[model samples]
Target: MPAPRKYPDELPERAVREVRTTSRPIAHVAKDLGIHKEALRGWVRQAEADAGERDDRLTAAEHEELKQLREEAAELRRANEILKAASAPFAQELDRPRTRPTRRSTA
Candidate 1:
């Protein structure tokens, strides 16, 4: 059986920076820090994901512009539908009204 594990009471703020500054393998870092290699890999993955999310958030103005454009398109479509409905009755009215034909006999 593997021996019981011991962990440091506190992790320094600069621990990651210090580890990255050196050219040592991650396994060496994990072993020297009394932690698991998989845990360090998990942290790296999470950090990359967070950076990607931050980059998306950085385009706040562009995102807002896109949202506004979508809303304007929806409004224009509704206006077009209302205009079509209003014009339909008038188009029918034009067809229904017709002058009666008149005929005059010539002498």
Candidate 2:
């Protein structure tokens, strides 16, 4: 599970908007908003990526899709392991020889 966010959702949006529109330094904006400069910078970068302004990072939608795909792949691997374990006994049974016992005649 993800850790809880330190700042509210609106704060990042407002900070990013300020950085974009006002052309002010990130540190200054962060100081004014009481946010960590690095966090605000990351938010700006992510917003740019989401807006198609940057290509170096995954957009929010792409990130979410990638996360979901990873979870699905993990689930498939777990299910495969379960099936392999369940079939082991049947595989061993198939490997054994089927021989009939001979009856002995009394003299």
Candidate 3:
């Protein structure tokens, strides 16, 4: 369900390494690779996360799990709402006793 990536993972890996090993600016590196500077910056951040250099972002698996959890939570909330709606009219009758209907005279 994920969108197609504009650039391949290998390309970013190579680009990040190029930026780190070379003294070139990130914009310069991204320009050389024909990628957007912001995209390249995201790749660098991701690389750092993968390397455990950054602690704020989640790892790929953790991020995936979180996405799945959020989706499941949304679905459960929807189901709860549906159940509530279906039982709305009946809920008020819980304490009432059943009664027989009065017969009507036929003409």
Candidate 4:
């Protein structure tokens, strides 16, 4: 699980908007908003990625999809392990030789 956010949900958007519209330095904006400058800078970068302004980082939607795909891959691997474990006994049985009973002559 993700750690709880230190700032409110709206703060990032507000800070990014402030920086974009006012052209103020990130440190100054962060100081005015009581936010960490690095965090605000990261938010601005993410916002730019979301807006298609940057290509170096994944967009928010792509990030979410990648997270979901990773979870799905993990789940599939777990299921495959369980299936292999469950089939092991049957596989061993199949590998063993079976003997035919000899017919008895009538006396």
Candidate 5:
């Protein structure tokens, strides 16, 4: 006859609280809890992935905004350069000495 299948044991209350509070490795706690390492690892990984994805989405949005801002700054710089190039000749003309015409005296 086949041996009766053993059910998994419930984890200790204190250990459960510790796992919740400290964010320690579930595999380590699982050892004390007398559960399979793979099962605990699966739960931990799923929870971690879910939490990480939430923060990742926010980071991605910030990155896209930064990229757009950088492009706008670069475009403004290019416009400023063009304006400077266009104004250089006028600036030089203003800097040159002005010649005055002598007035002729009428008798």
Candidate 6:
């Protein structure tokens, strides 16, 4: 299982909002808050994305959906592989012609 979120969604939003309102450099605020500068940078980017600032990153819901779709695709592929493996011997048997049994002679 993955670790629980270190920072909740609202916290990041609040942090970004504070930085935006105060016009303070992220590094300084992040230092004050004891958070990594890069983590704050990511929060800012996510905030921008939510506000339609960047097109490069997916929104949280879109990101979750993409992850689920990828997992479903991988599961379907595994099922197909398993079906192929399970049917291989049966397929080989089907390919052979059936022979009639010989009749025994009665004296």
Top candidate (TM-score): 4
Tens-digit per-residue lDDT, 1-107, candidate 4: 89998999999999999999999999999999998999999999999999999999999999999999999999999999999999999999999999999999998
In order, candidate lDDTs are 0.64, 0.97, 0.90, 0.98, 0.67, 0.88
lDDT of 1 by residue, 1-107 (tens): 54653444244223444455785676777778767877665444444444564452435456579988999999999999999999999999988969888977797
**Candidate 1 wrongly placed segments (more than 4 Å):** 1-58, 95-100, 104-107
Question: Candidate 2 on 1-107: residue-level lDDT in tens?
Answer: 89998999899999999999999999999999998999999999999999999999999999999999999999999999999999999999999999999989998
Query: Model 3 reaches what TM-score against the true structure?
Result: 0.74
- What is residue 13's positional error in candidate 3, in angstroms? 2.3
Pick out the ten consecutive residues of candidate 6 with the lowest summed lDDT: 6-15
Q: Per-prediction RMSD in angstroms?
A: 12.5, 2.0, 4.8, 1.4, 15.7, 2.8
lDDT of 3 by residue, 31-84 (tens): 989999999998888878878999998877788899999999999999999999
Most accurate candidate by lDDT: 4
List the candidate 3 regions with Cα displacement exceeding 4 Å.
1-4, 95-107
For residues 9-101, write the lDDT of model 5, one tens digit per residue.
344335555676887887788787777767666445444444574442334346579988999999999999999999999999999999999
Q: What is the lDDT of residue 58 in candidate 6?
A: 87
lDDT of 6 by residue, 1-107 (tens): 77888877587777888788999999998888777889999988877877888999887777889999999999999999999999999999999999999999998
Which residue pairs show collisions in model 4?
none
Per TM-score, what order, best first? 4, 2, 6, 3, 5, 1
Candidates 4 and 5 compared by TM-score, better number: 4
Q: How accurate is candidate 4 locally (lDDT)?
A: 0.98
Q: 85, model 6: CA deviation in Å?
A: 1.7
Clashing pairs in 1: none
lDDT of 6 at 107: 81
- Lowest summed lDDT window (length 10), candidate 2: 5-14
Q: Considering summed lDDT, which 10 consecutive residues are worst modelled in model 5?
A: 5-14
